[model samples]
Target: MNKLAWVLVSISFVVGSSAHAQKEIPKAEGYDQCPLGYINTLGTKCVSPIYYEVEPTYGEACESGWMNIGAGYCKKKTILGIF
Candidate 1:
């Protein structure tokens, strides 16, 4: 056994080049028109927009009762405010 036939041809060429480098991301064409909070999950790649707080505008300045909640941070809008 010549080193088990070169280790079975190097383990089938490393499992056929890792199954052809696992590639399967081709289906774009308005990928479900990703927008609000974006998310396409590989239909062509769009997942990237999950803000949770901080989105106020016009001279932003949240504090007394907190507001802005888009992606910067400012929650407490109502909860018997205290902290």
Candidate 2:
């Protein structure tokens, strides 16, 4: 009987401690504890992207690429294959 009661209590506590149960307590007035650490660029709270390096060769320009056909990317006319 005691073992069953203890098991039930533990299960309830585990379920109640889920992420959904987390409520951000406002620190000042219009802000909370930042959810975890920082606010994302999209104004959401959680893990965000970490910049490691730049793009690969035939890199970023303004628009064009092998995929986009023509705009401003690689900037090479032969590479553009428009001739």
Candidate 3:
């Protein structure tokens, strides 16, 4: 039926768009070089693209345990466990 075909098309479109939204960036051995759309943290871990927003800091400082990711946005740092 036409309705069934439309439903299949819709589902395929959604799946395809979701898959294309985010491409996995390879992890680096160090904290300096992160692929596009990822932020390099102090622990050498790359955060998500959602946290890579740039805002105005206006001379304010980031909170404790959070790193100032340029502009005014502060991203939480990854804490390694001693265990």
- Give each model a TM-score: 0.23, 0.25, 0.30
lDDT of each residue in 1-83, candidate 2, tens digit only = 99999999988865653433222222222333232222334343322132111111233443443222121112122223452
lDDT order of candidates, top first? 3, 1, 2
User: Model 3: runs farther than 4 Å from truth?
Assistant: 1-8, 16-26, 50-83
| Candidate with better TM-score, 1 vs 3 | 3
Give per-residue CA lDDT, model 1, range 1-83, as digits (tens).
99999999988965654442212222234334433343447455444343222222334566776664332234344334432
Please report the candidate that would top TM-score against the real structure.
3
Displacement of residue 31 (Cα, Å) in model 3 is 6.0
> What digit string (tens of lDDT, one per residue) describes model 3 on residues 1-83?
99999999988965654553333333443325544446656454455544322222345786665566542344444433110
Task: Candidate 1: give the clashing pairs.
Answer: 53-69, 53-70, 53-71, 53-72, 54-69, 54-70
Task: Evaluate model 3: give its lDDT.
Answer: 0.47
**Candidate 3 or 2, higher lDDT:** 3
Angstrom error of the Cα, residue 32, model 2: value is 14
Instruction: Give per-residue lDDT, candidate 1, residue 32.
Output: 42
RMSD of each: 18.7, 20.0, 11.6
lDDT for each candidate structure: 0.42, 0.33, 0.47
